[model samples]
Target: MPVVGIIAEYNPLHNGHAHHLEHVRKLAADEGIVCVLSSNFVQRGEPALLSKWARTEMALAAGADLVLELPSAFACSSAEYFASGAVSILNSLGIIDCLSFGSEEGDIDVLKTAADILAFEDDDFREILKSELDKGLSFAVSRQNALKTVLTGKSGQNIEKAAEAIDQPNNILGIEYIKAIKRFNSNIEPVTIMRKGQGYKSLDRTSPFSSATAIRHHIRELPDLRAISNDPFLKSNMPEACLNILIKETESGRHPIFPEYYSDIILHSFRNMPAENIASLPYMEEGLENRLKRAAIESVSVDEMVSKVVTSRYPASRIKRIMFSMLTGMTAEFLDELKSNGYAQYIRVLGFNDTGRSLLSQMRKKASLPIIVKPAGYKKLDTLAKKLFEHEIRSTDAYVLGYRSPGQRIGGQEYTSSPIISVR
Candidate 1:
C-alpha cells in the first residue's frame, strides 16, 4: 500500500483537522493514511484535551487508516525535534510515500528553499545566528533574523517573503518536516495542505474551521457537555462522530485534561528534586534550572511557576518542556545519548483499520525498527529500547493521574492496553 504520514497533535479533532485529513486522503488517493500523533502531551507543552486512544478513534473516524504514537520525548518537545522524531518513525516504516502537513503558506517550494538553507547551515549562517543571539534576542527571533539576513544576501530570490515564512507556526513546522526528510535522506515526498480559518492562537469559533485553541476554549466555557447536542455552534466546529466521542469521554470524566490539573505533581516533583538533578534535564541550561527550582518553591500554580522562569530567551513552552522532562525523569545525558543514536528504536502503534492492517503487513516486511502493536510488546525490545519506552509508559501513568474521575485513575494503561482496532 502507498502510505502517507502525518505528524499531528490532534489534541482534539476539530473541523480544521478533518479538513486536513480530507486533503491528505485526496493526496494519498488509494493509499493508506498513517499518522504519528502526540501521546498525553503536545508540542505546545500542554496535556492533550483528549487521550491518545480517543484521538486515534477520532482520526480513524475522520479517514486516517492508521495511528502511531510519537513518544513523549518528541511529543512535548520543540518543533525541530518533534518533527525529527515523527519523520524518523515514518521513514523507519519504509512504506510512506509522502509526508503531509497543514501550512498557512501551502507552498512547498518556498518552505523547501528555507529548509535547505537551515539544513545546510554554513559558517556564515552560524556567525549571523550567533550575532543575533548576542543581541539578546530570543532563539526564534534570532533564527528568523539570521535566516532573513542570509536569504537577502543571496542573488535573485524573494528574501522578504522567505524570511517572513518562518515566523508563522505551520510554516515553521513545515520547514522542520522538510528538514527532517532531508536529515534522514528519506524518499518520502513533502506535501503542504493550506490551512483554513483563524490563526493558530485565535479564539474565534465563528468559522467552521476553528483553531484547536478556540475549540478548547469553547468546551471549557461550558459547565458540562450535557447541552452539547443542542449547541449547533460547537457541533459545527468538529465532526459529529468526533464530537460524540469527546462528549462520551468527558461524561466519563476523562476528557479535557489541562496542565493545571497536574500542577501539584509537577510542583512537588520540582520542590523535592535536588538542584544538582535539575541541571541533568534536557534543555535545562545557563542556571535556568536554579531559577526553576526557586520558582517551584515560590509559586502556587503551574502558570505562575512557568511565568516566573520564562524569559525572552526561554519561552513558556521551553520552560514547560523542561518542567515536564523533570516530571517524567528525562535526563540531559540520556537524551544526548539518544540523539547520538539518531533513530527511533521502536514504532508504537495506537490504532488501525483494515487498510491500516494491510499497511502494517507491508511494514513488517519493510520496516527497519520493531513494530509494537501492544504494550506487552515492549518486553521483546532490547535493553536501551526498553529504557526509552519505559519513559513513555511512565508518562501515560502520569497522564492518567490528571483524569477528573478518581475511579478512572488506574495506572498501567500502557501495559494492559491494546491498540484501538477501528472496524471502519
Candidate 2:
C-alpha cells in the first residue's frame, strides 16, 4: 500500500489536528498515513502537555495508521534540523509516496519555489544573508531580506508573494520540509493543507479550532484536570477521543507537563556546568554560553533565565533549545555526527494499528535504516545509533521528572514501556 507521511508534535491532539488527519485519509485514499511525532520534548524545547505515549494514542485514535518517534536531538532543534530529521526518516522508510503538512500558504508551488531558493543558496544569496545578519537583525528577518534582494528582478511579483509566504510560521516549516526533501533527493511528493483557525502562537480560544498554544494555555489555567471533563472550551476545540485520552492521563497525574516543572533541575544543572561545556551544546555560539551561565546564576526560574539571555539574535526558542541540550547532554559534536550519518539512524515505532503493522512489515524489508519496535532492538544497532538511542533515553529520564506523580517520575521507562498498539 502507498504511504503518506506527516511530521508533527501533536502536543495534544486538538480538533484542528483531527481535521487534518481526516483530510489526509481522503487525500491518501487507500494509502496508509504515517505520522512522525516529536517525543516528550517538542520543537519549542518544552515538555509536551502529555507524554509521548499518550500523544501516540491520540494520533492513533485520530486516524493515523502509524506513529514514529522523532529523535530528541532533532525534535528540539531549530526548524531546519527538525524538518530535516523528520523528512530524512520518511525518506528512509522507502514506502512514503507523499509528505503532507499544514501550512498557512496552501500553495505547493509557492513553498517549493521558496524552498528551492533556500536549498540551493548561491554565493550572492550567502553574501546578502551575511550583510543582513551584520545589520544586527534576527536570522529569520535577515533571511527574508536576503531572499527579497536575491529574487528581486528574477521572479518579479512572485518574489513578494514568496517572501510573504516565508514569514508565516507554518509556511516557514513547510518550506523547510520541501528543502529537506530536495536535500535528501527523495521521491516523496510534497502536499500542503491550508491551516484552519487561529495562528500557530495565538492563544485565542474563540474559534472551534483553537491553536495548540491556546488549548495548552487553557488547560494550564485550570485549577486541575478534573475540570477538563466539564470544560466547554476543550469540548469544542478537541475531538472527543483525544480529549478523553487527555482526561485519562490527567486523572493519572500525567497530564499538563510543563517546562517550569524542570526549572530547578535545569538551574542546578546549569550552575554546576562550566561555560566551556555549555559552549559545546548545539546552537551555542559567540560567548552566548557565558551569558547563559551568568543568567543561570542570577535567575530563579527557567522563564527568568530565558528572559535574561534571549535577544534579537538569540531568540527565546533558541535559548530553550540550548538549555534543553544542556539538560539532556546533547552536544554539537554528537548532532554533527548524526547529521553526517544521514540525520536518522533508526526508525522507532511509537504506535501502530493493523494498517501500520503492514507498513512496518514493508519497512523491515525496504527501509534504509533499522526498524526498532522495542528497546531490545537497541542492542542490535551500530555504535553511532547506540549513542543516539542513549541520548533519547537520557532525554526521557529527564522528561519524566516533570510528571506530577512521584511514581510516574521513574526513569528507564524507555526500556519498560512498549509502543501503543491500537486494536482497530
Candidate 3:
C-alpha cells in the first residue's frame, strides 16, 4: 500500500484535522496514513492538551493507520528543527510515498519555490537575512523580508503574494516541510490542503471547523472536565470519535494541559540555575539568559515571566521553548550531538490499527532505523540513539508534572506504557 505521512500535534483532534485526514485518504486511495505526532510537549512549547497516547487514539479513531511519536526534543523545538526531525523520520520509514500537510497557500508549486529559496540560500538572500536580523527583527519577519526581496529581484514574482503565502503559520510550516524534503533528498512528494475555517490563531467558536487554538481555549475556560465534555460547542466542532476520546481522557484528568501548569517548576528550575548554566540551554543567545534569569526572579507565573523577557527579536514561543528546554535539561551540546547523528534516532510507535500493524511488519525489514514498539527496545540501540531515548524519557517525566491527577504525575510512564492498539 502507498503510505502518506503527516506531521502534526493533534493536540485534540477536531473537525479541521478530520477534514485534512479525509482529504489525505482520498488522495492516497485510503492507503496507509502514517502520522508523526508530537510527544507530550508540542511545537508550541507547551504540554499537549491530552496525552500522546490519547491523541494517538484520537488519530487512529479518526482515520490514521499508524501513529509514530516525534521525539520530545524536536517536537518542542522551532519550525526548522521540528520539520527536519519529522521529515527525517518519514524518510527513514522507507514506505512513505507522499507528505501531506495543511497550509493557507494550497499551491504546491508556490510553496516549493519558497522552500527551494530557503533550502538553498544564495549569498544575496543570506546577506539580506543577516541585515534584517541585525536590525532586531524576529527571525520569521527577517526571513519574510529577505524572501520577498529575493523573489522580487530574482524572478519578478508577485512579491506581495509570496509574502502573504509565507505569513500564515501553517504556510510557514508547509514551507519548512518542503525545505526538509529537499534537504534530505527524500522521494516523498509534498501535498498541501488549504486550511478551511477560522484563522490559525483565531478564537472564534461559532463554526464547526474551529481552530485547535479555539478548542483549547474553550476547554480551558470551562470549570471542569465534565463541563468541557458536555460543552455543545465542542460536540459541534470535533469529530465524534475524537470528541469521545478527548472526553474520556479529560474525565481521567489528563486533558486541557496549559503552560501555566509548569510555572512553579519552571521558576524553580531557573531560580536554581546560574546565568552561565542558563546560557548552556538550546537557543540561548546574546545574553538572553541573564534577562530570562531576572524575569524568573521577578515574575510569579510563566506568562508574566515570558511577558517580561519577550521582545520583537525574541518571541513568546521562543521564550517558552527555552524555558521548557531548561526544565527538560535539553542543552546546546545535546542538540548538536543529535544533529550530528541523524536528527531522529528511532521510529517509536505510539499507536496503530490493523493496517498499521501490517505496515510495521514491512517496516521491520525496510526501515533505515530501528522500529521501537516497546520501550525496552531502547536497550538495544546504539550510543546516540540510547541517549536520545533517555532524554525523551526525562522529558515525558517533566511533562507529566502538569497533570491534574497525582497518580498520572508519576515518572517512568515512558518505560511502563506500551503503544496504544486500536482495532477499527
Candidate 4:
C-alpha cells in the first residue's frame, strides 16, 4: 500500500493536529498516513505535555495510520536539521510516497522555488545575510531579508507577498521540509497544507485554536480545565491527564521533572567542564558555548539561564534546545554519529490500530528497513536506540515521579511509567 509520511511533534494532539491528520487522510485516501513523531521532548526544547505513548495512541486514534518516533536528536534541532532528520527517516521507510506538512503557504510551487533558491545561496545573498546578522538581526530574519533582496535585486523575482515570506513558524519549518526533500532527492513528494487559523506562535484563541504555545499558556492559568472545555478551542484534545500530572508536580513542591533530572548533570557539566566542551553539547553553535557556560554557572533557574543567553542572534528557543542536550547527556558528536547512520532502520511503533496494523503488515514486504514492532523486544536496537528510548522512558518516569508524594521512592515511579503500551 502507498503511504504518506507526516513529520510532526503532535506535542499534545490538539485540534490543529486532528485537522492536519484528517486532511492528509482525505488527500491520500488511496494510501496509509504515517506520522513520524518526536517523542517526549519537542523541537522547542520543552517536555511534551504528554508521554510519547500517550501522543502515539492519540495520533492513531485521531487518524494517523502509523506512528513512528523521530529520535530526540533530530526532534530538538533547528529548522534545517529537523527537516533533514524527518525527511531521511521517512525515506528509510521506503513505502512513503509523499510527505504532507502543515504550513502557512499551501502553494507548493512557491515553497519549492524558495527551497531551490535557498539551497543555492550565492555570494550576494551570503553577504547581505552576514551584514544583517552583523547588524544584530536574528539569523532567521537575516536569511529571510537576504533572500528577498537577492531575489529582487538579482533575479527580478519580487515577493509581493511580503507578509507571507518571513519567519512565520510553520512556513519556516515547511521551507526546511522542502529543502530537505530536495537535498535528499528522494522519491517522496513534498506537499504543504495551508494552516487555517492564527499562525504557529499567535496567542489568539479564535476557533480551532492557536499554536501549542497559546494552548500551553492558557492551560497553565486555569485552576482546572472545566472553564475552557466549553470553548470551541478546548475540546478535551489537550490531554487533561498530562496537565494534572503537572498539577501534581506543583502541589508536591517537586521541581519540574526536567529540572529534577538534569540539574545535577548540568551543574556538574558547568562547574567541571571547560567552556569548549559545551560546544560539543547537541545543538550548540555560534560561540554560544561560552555564553551558556557562564549562564549555567550563574543562572539559578532554567528560565534565568535561557534569559541570560538569549539574543536576537541566539533565539531563546535555540538556547533551550542546546541546554536540553546538556541536561540529557546528549552531545553533538553522538547525534552526528547517529545521523551518519542516515535513515531510520527500525519502525518502532509508538502506537497502532486496525488501519495502522494493516499498513504495518503491508509494508513488511516492501519496506527497505526493519519495522521494529517493539524497541524493548530487540536486544540490539535496545542498545542503539537506548538514548532515544531512555529519554522517552525518563520523561515518563519524571512525569510519574511528579505524581508521587514528596519523599516517595524515585525508583518505583520509574518503572511504573515505563510500561510498554500493548499494541492490540
Per-candidate TM vs. native? 0.97, 0.98, 0.98, 0.82
What would the per-residue lDDT of candidate 2 be over residues 1-424, giving only the tens digit for each residue? Answer: 4579999999889988898999899977666999999987889978888888999999999999999999899999989999999999999998999998899988898888889899999999999999998987778889988987877777556566787898899999999999999999999999999998899999998999999999999988888679999999999999999999988998998667889898999998888897888889998788888899889999999999999998888889989998888888899999999889889999999999998998899998899999899888999999999999999999999898888989988999989989999998
The lowest-lDDT stretch of 10 consecutive residues in candidate 4 is 413-422
Point out the worst 10-residue segment of candidate 3 by lDDT: 153-162
Clash-forming residue pairs, model 3 = none
lDDT of 1 by residue, 208-307 (tens): 8889998888777877667766677778998999998888898888767888988898999889888888888877777877899899999988999999
Candidate 1 segments whose C-alpha is farther than 4 A from its true place: 155-158
User: What is candidate 4's TM-score against the reference?
Assistant: 0.82
Off by over 4 Å in 4: 154-164, 224-233, 236-273, 285-287, 343-345, 381-424
Estimate the TM-score for candidate 1. Answer: 0.97
Candidates 1 and 3 compared: the better one by lDDT is 3
> Against the hidden true structure, what lDDT does model 3 obtain?
0.89
Those runs of model 2 whose alpha carbons end farther than 4 Å from true positions after fitting are none
Q: Report the lDDT of model 2 for residue 211.
A: 97
Ranking by lDDT: 2, 3, 1, 4
lDDT of 2: 0.90
After aligning candidate 2 to the native by TM-score, how far in Å is the CA of 329 from where it should be? 1.0
lDDT winner among the candidates? Answer: 2
The residue pairs in collision within model 4 are none
